[model samples]
Target: MSFILTLANLLSIAAAASGWLKLSDGPWSAREGLMAVEDASGIVMVGGRANLGLAAQHDVWRTPNGSSWERLPDAPFAGRAYHAMLSHGACIFVMGGQTVALLGDPFFNDVWRSCDGGETWDSLGHAPWQPRAGLAVATHNGRMVVAGGCFGSSIGAGRKFLNDVWATRDGASWELLTANASWSARSGPRLVDFNGRLLLLAGEVGFTADTQLGDIWESGDGATWTLLTATPAFSARSGHGVVNAGGSLLLIAGWHDAKCLHDQWLSEDGVVWRMVSNATWACTADACGRFDFWPVATSSGLLLTLGGSNAYSTFGKLWAETWALPLLGGGRPLRGGSVAMH
Candidate 1:
């Protein structure tokens, strides 16, 4: 009889803990592309350019408090835009961005790493992702997963929108996970980890008479992808951001047909999608929102996003946005919120 009572108590404890995780918010918020990196310490964001043209730059930001922000080290890389960065243990690995040469034909595959947080960066090596723009990457297990981006002879016309998956641990080498026609050939798609699995969600493809897709997919491994959701969440979007907020995965705003979208969604499994409360917030445009937002987990247990660029404004806006949903037991579905801009 005593053993039965003990078993019952243990089950109760497990159920309560899971419920706490479901309602809690992990670290979250928007930041410039260069400044963002996820590690055990928190999220760190590095250098970013204010305009479209690439001219070597170095600026940085980091967050431990969801409500406030702090400045970190300026990156050492020559100024470039549309680059990718990820966190591994104590180091943040950054790769693939646009660097202007003499004729204004700008693109590169150089890789770098930052050890002392985001304060400084060191050149790692050449990347194997090829010269591309609006490409997306996310780190999982011991490897960095990369897939589907735009590259080519021309900036607009004849651009190669890809559907290939690549993974690397050392920047000097790359492993092609899958190159099948299975994935929707896209650029600017968001890559993230959901429910212990990897997911590639939403992006754009084609030019001239353009095209875009907001379709969602998930994978156990980086290779074969499974079609989870066929419909686009709000509209066909690209250049938008997604991150792990609280315990649930959150999809933030991005560009759709040259217009900006602020609609949001939440996923526990990442396959089934649900629009969450206040998912669509602001309607604006600029360079900052083009990449992933830096969501850092804090000691007080809040998720935060700092300042970033908007597509419409020349003088970019900085933010202290918080998805401060109250801690409720179990997963109480909070769906749909007003879409507005501050």
Candidate 2:
């Protein structure tokens, strides 16, 4: 039987003084599929789908701390969404996403790396994996590992969901660890490096509302995976944010049951989860409560999320509000601010 999460259960562990604190909306316009990672230098965000998913922005943005954000130069590669980005060693790597504009093929398998923050990038050539979007990625065992995504255009035929796994120490070449993972093929799943293992979390099979999953899986090596739970304490979801925050695993907002979710979950191991009460951001606010966004766990004991979209089909609504949740200490109440929508 599944473990049901109730209001009393959520309130029992929720700290009254702790919740999501809204920071100033950064420089970037409202967009979704934008990827961000926290490294030694700071937090760097990359390309996203803007203008109602018709325009893809190649521009990069960075913030040393969440308070201030600066727009970096446009990337060398074409702008795309549903791509994956992560920090490994001294390199920040980006790979595999689809373009919004329907011109030629929309999928991309090319890889690029930035050594000097997001100021500049060098092409690492194409990857071994097929062109895909919404793929899950994480840094594991001093290498970057990528798994599962959707391949095909927004309105094209022959669309395919994948469950393959690949890893690389350098972006130039990739090793296929597994052609098929134990989990079902899905897109927009959350992959994180936690407790010396790679944990894969809930994701969706397609655009259908009922296709979302809440299963959790883990792997020490990219080749083999073990299922931790088929049904978690949280509801089935997709496009959620999963990160390692101060040695603990955190699952943030996502889409579930045809509605945008604003709740947060905490776990020491992938098998058990706890709802972090009062830690959720405001979903009722204008252009708030997003899925398919990136969340980074900083060295400062704070979990940060910047931009994401609400719906799955069109990805029409996007958000730019920056929210920070304190994982270790007390958090302030929700604050109000104007969110600029383009």
Candidate 3:
């Protein structure tokens, strides 16, 4: 028994020592790719830029493991970018986004859902809110919530930043939670469920220069929001991915000061934060940064950073590559039991 125990301990140590988080290329490629949540089956990648030209794509793909990707049938809706996708109950819902065009980008308030995984999709028609993109959407308090985005045809052209909050039990019907929340109008804010509460992280405030945000907001009910911190530990960033890892919240890469960031931060209570990794991976235009990359927690408890653009404002520099890291304290075996590395 002593000999067996010693061997098991050595194996565990070996696994941990060799298990440092590393970024590897996923099977699928996209100029601009976005990852949906981990459903009962697996994780899904939604619409992205398909080429160097300013073209939005409506293709859907799924993967059980990040290495293997299977493309689903093309979605019914037109191609779009900077949209929000979430899984709720028996269906996956996709909402507001903008389609690239030469004249001006046309935003959509239309919502759609897929019951048969990503095999097929059904339109839920237009949402009550005005057409917009870069909005935050998530499931909170037994309902789906959509909040804070930009409503404009193009950047700096009749652009309007929003802070309105809306909720829906069924994807087809939406109720206004608040016309205006306490948080300032912003786009690309990280809206995620943490500690059974809906938390909003930093985003871009305006279309003008020097308007990124790093504030945090919390809410039990969708209507009332409390500002947790006006100034967060990280600098003002937009398009960052936030996910609940174990019990703590992890903030991934984002856009800051005309540059795509590759930093990572973790927080226990949302107010206090600590930077865990610095430039573990730098998402550049060619290599792809965290800009607009939707980070999803896999069923195996790994952080999968999906498709996103390395270009902050320009199109055609989308990344098809996927990168993942284990959750905090996730590499070790629990107690005395041996664990397999993902």
Candidate 4:
């Protein structure tokens, strides 16, 4: 009996040391991934393209352990993609993205809030900023700040990119922090609140090849910005996910030069980045190689990534699988170490 107990303990340790675990499949069929957030109750997924027709969806779902999912009612607005979903205090907010249109996709400046943990939503009316999609947003110092995205239809000509910044304490009203910031006009940059400040990572400028950038910027008040590095340690890529794991920040998978990247990086500060993982590449869609998918940092210090897709039918496939990695303890990098997967 003692030997059997010892064997069980060893197995448990080995499972934990495996680095990643594939949890149960999400309820919905794979499509373009949505923005996800974890609150006191559980993790909530909101708004993304559907797998059937590639149309935007307004469905909301929640999960406690990533093994099971509970689908909430549809949101009060039309289906959209590239939107932002964040949890602040007792409420979860969904803001700005483009809606599926037959003629040309129209951008949205609307903001919706759910006070009872995504059970029901109320439109806060349109935000003060212009309608846009692929903007980076995060709650900083008890206020939400939005920065940089592309406006206009992505399919044809006349597309406009922006680098403007705005902030709001409440969802209804907003204040323009800056008309234009130092960073170039871009879309799909990864934004996060780190150490009470806002950090913006790499993003793509125009809808074409050779437009991705690896710049990193920091802002204290969202008005004045500081360029941490014009060129970062990692390659230039858009559609990546960033999370503040403990005091350190982690950058997840994104697309770089037609390749779907599976590499991950970590930084104690925003400037110096170190590659930590080189997982296998899966998707290769030009518009949605895991784009717009948000990674949730759980209460137990484990990071969870839900459904995502590449959006290209041939190369990109929708995913319902859940991936997890433990980020507590000394999971951070020890400065100046060689780039190696953990």
Score every model by TM-score: 0.73, 0.88, 0.86, 0.88
Query: 275, model 1: CA deviation in Å?
Result: 2.0
The best candidate by lDDT is 2
Q: Provide backbone clash counts, one per model.
A: 28, 0, 5, 0
Q: For model 3, how many clashes?
A: 5
lDDT per prediction?
Answer: 0.58, 0.78, 0.74, 0.75
Candidate 2 — which residues are off by over 4 angstroms? 1-18, 154-157, 283-288, 329-342
The residue pairs that clash in candidate 3, if any, are: 29-320, 30-320, 31-318, 283-288, 283-289
> Top model by TM-score, which number?
4
lDDT of 3 by residue, 257-322 (tens): 777777667788999877765553432242445577777776575666776766756654666666
Segments in model 3 whose C-alpha atoms lie over 4 Å from true places: 1-27, 103-105, 155-157, 207-209, 282-288, 329-342
lDDT of 4 by residue, 266-337 (tens): 888988887776551222234333544557877766677776655433235667777666565524422211
What would you estimate as the lDDT of candidate 3?
0.74
Query: Regarding TM-score, does 1 or 2 come out ahead?
Result: 2
Clashing pairs in 2: none
